[model samples]
Target: MRRILALLLLAALGALAVWLYPLARPLARYGALPKGLDRPLNLLVLGVSPEYSGYHKRAPERFRGLTDTLLLVRLDPGANRVVVVSIPRDVWVNLPGHGWHKINAANPLGGPELSVRAVEALTGVRVDGYVMVSLEALRRAVDALGGVRLCVERPMHYTDRAAGLRIDLEPGCQRLDGAQAEAYLRFRKDALGDIGRIQRQQAFFQALKEQILSPWGLLRLPQAVAQAEPYVRTDLDRETIGRVLGFALKRPALVSLLLPGRFGNGWAVDQALWEEARRVYFEGQEVAPASSLGRVVAVVYGPGEEERAQEAARRLRAMGFRVLFRPVDQTPGRTEVLENGPGLLARDLAEALGVPYRVSGEAVLGADLTLRLGGDGRGL
Candidate 1:
């Protein structure tokens, strides 16, 4: 009887291995970074809305509307860095087979393919793949992750009864639910208009990244992906997606930048800075030290931080930068460096000052870089 039982147990184990082989085969095949991703990979990501008529009614076919948010994300496995550049929707670009129009019109004109072409033409960056996600996907993903926490810079109040959109958020840091997150991302009624919306989007993404890197977020990631998958459209295969997610789990460096441009009739692209951005960001070229030496640096201080700001200005001046002082009414919680141009000088300055930096158009007017002294500046 003992001999018979031993044989039966061995048979059962063999059968289980056979059953699991198919499931585990792919994992073994993609155990390392895929060949396609050995070098830098660029992906065009679009947040698409559906066409809507009055009374918040969607068209029967659910035609793709304007791309509200456009991002060119580069994943560099060699450097272990993810660079995200946000392109303003209102930026003028010439669409293939169509005349000059806002960049957002590409999606509605054709689809992700045309949008990809438009972006490639504008930035001269080859897109390896495209990910088009609907607003519903964003809501579901955020809800699955138990919402994301973000700091609201100011009170936001807006309502569009026709589109069934309403935003009423007070100034504070708080966790936002699915509906609230959508509202926060879509609100553009502030003085900065689309530019302010872009800034808020960047902030939202930073918050989302933080949430995803947390232990709790990891635990819920599979569920979030499953819930949002149906609403997302991507050209990437499952194997590639798996590899990308695995890479993200390693916690690579994240850098965010806005497309270098100035706002006028439409966002006018600064050709020279744009080229510099392409080289430095997409091509992985280093910024020449001489190129950054002539930049005008503005040291903006909050209440009671004048001395620290002056000291910072002096340090910058010593480093061959032209420095100026500016004061603001708002008190920031932490030090922040903002770059008005396309270069990485803000990042270099942030590293030198041991603070954080962001590429923003909201920097002090006529200044190439602005360093805002916050409560944390007291230590300087």
Candidate 2:
């Protein structure tokens, strides 16, 4: 509901090509960002599923559904990049009053506040702001936007009567209604499970971006905003919305990442992987000191550079830095150092490899840096 309102209002404002700060003043007051805040901001966005009016009632034990979607969106005006990190619902973490449990429990335990705290504890990142949208709000928001087009990768068939979720989708490119979209995002019955679902959500986001920014979407903004106003909830005001929307509309560089982790006994993130994830996606700096050569976790080379990667890894190990050799999806034109966090280590390694260094969107999880051995590395 709140998201629907925010989207509609922001779209309307964007289309008008004018700032009605006075009119939006009231709405902005509710959840407005503090004035003159200019820095990288982290927003903990929770797609909540609280039981709302007109929604199907559930059993007492299952009445309060956990947060359906957990996303940390990092908006860096300086770099002009939007880094979106998805946290799987099942990732176990410590709860405030309760013992360690699945991270999603934070929402139902104490709403968004506790959820925010839990995330802060998990990621060691300060959340500047947050937005909680109910499932109903998300559904209506999608409908208000006239549905989003997506390419369903494979046939999806799932039914959970207890949860009142029924997903039956075919493989193809098509537009999805509000209900279908919700089901598509909620389905996690495949082999990859939640990880695969996260991938689909990322894809859905791309499609949603296209739909909301389209000309027709702009035209319908006023009506959508008007209809969604009552259901929306946020601490961000109109001015902040405008600013973020402006940057978002520019289609800045995007880094889509999942909190690096794996599930065995249960979903858990390795300490090293979490640290690297924070360094690259949140703090944007190295947590360990520069002299800690063991801090350098790296992937070695692209395709056809196996021998080079092996050789480089051998050298890096001798330098006391930990290195992981792996193949990349594509080969690079030249040798380059892909920095996941601060470029200090990457630059040093690049100097060693005699190649230039650059920030990378495709950062390897648990890696502090990636050495892409290109044709230039043939000499090394």
Candidate 3:
């Protein structure tokens, strides 16, 4: 019902605003958020189900339906680190006012206002903005981009009879259309269950982000904007939206991240760990120090460059990289800045560090100073 009203309001506003587009500058300015915020800015992202299919179709009569997908986007402009913290929608959390409940319940309690409060209470970081996307909106946008080419990390399998969603996982890498991508987002019950789905969501969002920032995607921006205007709800106003879109147009390397915190058995979000997440994110603290944690920082290079490789490790170490497990690989994955959430933060520091890791578990055997970032302990 609320979503319906919002959508109707959107349509009416769009119709009127198309004429009032000239007035949009002032109207738009009113809703603008403060730009130039510090990096790792927390953004609450919720994947909501479609409110209404069409005029003739009746709406589903459920308010407590599963939001299922939850992700906290940490945007750090200063350090250029984009950290995303993924929380299992089903993972129960210690909610304020009410006894423990699923974190998604924060929405029902209060829309963005309450959800922001709840997440802030949980992680102690101020949410810069909220992007409430209807499940359909994302699908539409994905389709508009001519269906994103998704890289499947692993086979995903799940069936939700109640939700009317089904997924079958195929191992290795694969591409998925918009519908398939939505299924990918909906699928859980892999080895990690809800947790696994969270990881996929990160990858999916990354792929979407990449696609949207692509040249062709930019050309199709008009359609994507149309799709989002009616269904997507966010506190960010048009100008802010335009500015961010411009950023995408210019600097499209927005990083994607999943908090490196591994939930224990049952996957319940612990109260204490919630605070830990807060510290890592809000305070720019490193959860795992480079000196102690086992990470292999391999300065990737071609064959017959062992001496140069070792020299690279020493160079990185001199620059304060842990360089724990050095490996000399002729071929390596493209360089990616992956962080293990706030857990890999160094105490007394303001930002979480992005340390290199062992490439797909391969060890480096030759090089001047092999850049291998591996192991299980913290470094000095």
Candidate 4:
């Protein structure tokens, strides 16, 4: 009896295959997806903000449920890895019948069923199931866990008199429970912007995953999981849960991909950015990397500055720009855009991957990085 109790405890914490191992067994089987089982299972997790209803229920003036928070969680039983990719709800995607629309709009038009269908239709990868959550539901769950610890690299703030949400904070670590976390998750107005918001969500999720794996976090598992269910709805079954648990324990390789490249500045909003976003979070996995013709640029920045460069590169690449360059330190001397490499290292690439031209420029931190296109440059 003592051993059994100990095992249960272990399983709860998401620790090694101790007491908690069997908890997911039943659900794992129920969840084993039928169609998209060839590749690892993909589960779509959508978060709908507070809903508004009226006479326009059927043909909603807006969406039934606005799925602003999007997460694509990939579970590989064979490889023992779990990967969750996040997508901005504002991202633009081409709707089958509606021309072009925001990715989150697919939810209200179809509900879980249509949302799943549209996501699968858009991304190419089969969506085994989906989990939907409402605003209050997630807020309660985060509160139940007594909030979570999150580290802020920089200060962030948002003001919504209508929604009655206001956010202001300085850099460093902080713990946000239900109300605070909910506010942070919903607000998108900040210097960092939506991309930065997604990054915060990702970091929060990653940290939560780490904490849950520990015995301490697992001790609160049942309560947390239970609190989540009311706010969360999913098509996943019993067996699927087990598979994920088992795989999560065995495969640390499970990665979280924001996407191939970036689309726009956090503050700059546009449909093209959304269009590229849809291509990445949804359609990217379905298409082969080779067949998906696009470019990847590496924008390198120094300490305290890499984030911008990294994001710029991601956006440019996602936009199908083949102009992938590394972010390097400014060369000592006059600054100018040249078909030159990092302190002359680019000379080899300039010769090898000959392009029409190369350009370079400079910018202050927290601003934009300068660029220069070459008239006739070569490099690999």
Global lDDT of each model?
A: 0.78, 0.69, 0.54, 0.52
lDDT of 3 by residue, 76-195 (tens): 565555556666566556666777777777776656666677667656667888877776777777776688766554556677655566687564335576678788887766555666
TM-score of each: 0.81, 0.64, 0.62, 0.58
Clashing pairs for predicted structure model 1, backbone only: none
The deviation in Å at residue 330 for candidate 2 is: 22
- The reply for model 1, stretches above 4 Å from the true place, is 1-36, 58-63, 291-294, 298-330, 340-344, 358-366, 375-378
As for candidate 2, its clashing pairs are 1-137, 2-231, 2-232, 28-237, 31-235, 31-236, 32-235, 32-237
Report the lDDT of model 2 for residue 207. Answer: 73
In candidate 1, clashing pairs total: 0
Question: Which candidate ranks first by lDDT, i.e. highest?
Answer: 1
Quick one: how many clashes does candidate 4 have? 46
Instruction: Please estimate how well model 2 matches the true structure, expressed as its whole-model Cα lDDT.
Output: 0.69
The superposed Cα distance between candidate 3 and the true structure at residue 264, in angstroms, equals 4.5
lDDT of 3 at 344: 37
**RMSD (CA, angstroms), candidate 2:** 9.6
User: What digit string (tens of lDDT, one per residue) describes model 1 on residues 266-294?
Assistant: 87877798788778778878767545587
**What TM-score should be assigned to candidate 3?**
0.62
